[model samples]
Target: MSVFVTVLSLSSLATILAALVSLADYHLNDYGVCTININGGTRTVDVNGGSSILSSLAKHKIFIPSACGGKATCGLCKVTMVDTISPVLPTEEPYLTAKEIEGGVRLACQVKVKRDLEILIPGEFLTVSQYQAKVEKITKLTYDIKKFRLRLLDPAQMEFKAGQYVQVDSKLYGAVREEVSRAYSISSAPSDRKAIELVVRLVPGGICTTFLHEHVKVGDKLTLAGPFGEFYLREGADHLIFIAGGSGLAPIRPMILDILKRKLDKKMTFFFGAVSRKDLFYVDYFRDLEARYPNFTYIPALSGAKPEDEWDGEEGLITEVVARNISDPEGKQAYLCGSPGMIDAALGTLREIGIGAEHIYYDKF
Candidate 1:
């Protein structure tokens, strides 16, 4: 019995020692230098080898749009190796389309910079910059939506289009304590240079939304790393129709303000939808804007209004109201922002109203 106890203790100590050694090696091992050629070698980044290419490029301020935070799930961190390439990994196969495979596209978050490599990035990446910022204000926009304003600290400023969105860095909660990022659109006009604002609706279990709603207070430092998406105005568009719901109004507000600031003389009609009066917000803001822009009209549609609530406005689904009102969309362009369902319904209505598919634009929240 004594001999057996001694053997068991020895085994346990050995296992613990092995774990410690393994961890030490992972942390202490030397990763030689690697070079990444960017934009056909128009730019290059020298970074430590053996880390994922996404992390390497991000360190140098080149951001690849990733939806799953830097994890491999979202399959958005796409890259085309411009140097010699390796065979695709099993983890990346499902995400790559056959065309992407033929074109040498691989997941940037998964590929390590094992050797000198060249990569091709979309043109938009050159314009996106990461920001270190301080929270300037956090105001209640509605009962459930709060507005956060971030005054950038480093690079100190940015130039983004009216409808573009940025990903806000988030601290983890529940079982996740690591820092991560989530995307939200800029609500303030681009003319507001010093600070940018975001309207965030509380998602019950959302990592970033929950942090902003519960833990984040008035003054906190943060890092945000994006100016992503291709949803914005199309100048020379014949006429403009805008649709939005809930916090989707964030992106649309900038679009409206952009139009106003630019003195766009185009015909514009804006529709805001809500489940009930409680869900409705920013009606007064829109009303004031409509008064300023004679060609612009603001319509508020309520899908679940109560008669006893003494409401007087267009009622029913936004799409239904749109179908009833707009009879001609032959030369019109539609911009939509809302929940996925509302945008989908609005798209169908545009189709039914004889609008060309090419004339519709949307950014669904």
Candidate 2:
């Protein structure tokens, strides 16, 4: 019995020592540097092993556009890996295609840098730069939506297509102890160089939105990286149809303003949808703009209007209202922004009305 006890103690000590060694290797012991050969040797970054590929590249100022800040939710930081790190993770399964998986495409956020690696990234992303910004003001647009005015402290001027978006970083706050980033469309017109605006609706249980609504202050400084996404007006599109729900108007607002700012002869019709009158915002602004621009039309729709609201505008689902008003959508370009369901319904309606799938652009969150 004494011999058996001594052997058990030895085994337990060996297990503990093994665990300590692994912990040291993972977090304490410094692994030597490794090189990341990017885009077929267009650039190379030497970073220490044991960090995520996304973060390692960022240390070298190579900003890969990630809306979820390496959390694997946005799936924007995908890259074709020419070298092996590990198999595709379950967190990345939903974002990758079968071909992408077979072709060695991996989520940069999920892959750890343990050795040298080769990755392929879009050449255009090399142009993305990080910016420092300050929250100049916050305007409550409705019960749930608020407009944030961010003044660019660095890179004082940003040249982005009106409908593009930027990933805003939320620093540590209540319930969220670590920093995170989420993309928000630019609501401010491109002509406004020094400052940009974002219209955000309170997303229940959303980390970034919670930080913006609860923790962020007017004078708080934040980091933003972007001008990403490709939901912009097609050049020389003569007729445009804009449909937005909730805070989806963030991107559409700037596109409309872009047209008016250029004094372009493009015909514009904007449809804004909400549940009730109280859920609506920016009605006066769009109405005022419509009054000024002869070629622009503003249509606000309420899907669930209260009797006390005395709603006189279009009622019922926005898809139905759109089908009724727009007779021929064949040659028109449609820009949609909303929840996935809203965008899907609008797409089907537009397609039925002869709008080609390619002509309909959307930003789905």
Question: For every model shown, what is its TM-score relative to the native structure?
Answer: 0.84, 0.89
lDDT of 1 at 114: 74
lDDT of 1 by residue, 1-365 (tens): 99999999999999999999978867886668988988887888899997899889888988887756777766778889865478888889988998888898999988988778988988898778988888989988778899999998886988888888888888866786777767788999999877899999998877788888877876788888778877888865757888888998899899888988888778888888888888888889889988877978999899999876477999999999888879987668888988879889999999999988888887543
Count of clashes, each model: 0, 0
lDDT of 2 by residue, 67-146 (tens): 78898988888889996668899999999999999989998899988888999998866777788999999999998899
lDDT of each: 0.85, 0.89
RMSD (CA, Å), each prediction? 6.3, 5.6
Model 2 scores a C-alpha lDDT of 0.89
- Which stretches of model 2 miss by more than 4 angstroms? 1-31
Worst 10 residues of 2 by lDDT: 172-181
Clashes of 2: 0
